[model samples]
Target: MSSAQWNAGQAHGEAQAKTEEWVKSAQNTANKACDKMADSRESAQHGKEQSAGFIQQGAIDGVKNTLGINEKK
Candidate 1:
């Protein structure tokens, strides 16, 4: 092959390699962001459940207190 043709092929190969590297890097970043979002969602759901439990308990206690059945603690 001529020197010019060989140089062009080399440049093409380098460009392809760089593009692939960029794609992988982008994929990794997106995956990390998605994982963070999922974690936040799970944490929010857990907090909601805890708050609901507290509310239910308060309602139960209110009923007992109104009936003069409050337990000694």
Candidate 2:
């Protein structure tokens, strides 16, 4: 209706748009960071599993050696 009222409405719309854009950007960044952290955790878990396997094998080998069993390899 009035020019001043129209300008105020436009400003409000622009501010809302800007706020929405910032929120989306922040969400995208957070999601990427969460994904990276999850990947790192998975890698660490795999490493831990491998280490445990190695320890178990070492224990088995130690028992065989103590019992004077000849190892093929």
RMSD in order of candidates: 1.3, 1.5
Highest-TM-score candidate: 1
lDDT tens string, model 2, 1-73? 9999999999999999999999999999999999999999999999999999999999998999889894856
Per-candidate TM equals: 0.89, 0.87
Judging by lDDT against the true structure, name the best candidate. Answer: 1
Clashes of each: 0, 0
Off by over 4 Å in 1: none
Q: Residue 15 in model 2: shift from native, Å?
A: 0.6
Candidate 1 C-alpha lDDT tens digits along 1-73 = 9999999999999999999999999999999999999999999999999999999999999999999999956
lDDT of each: 0.98, 0.96
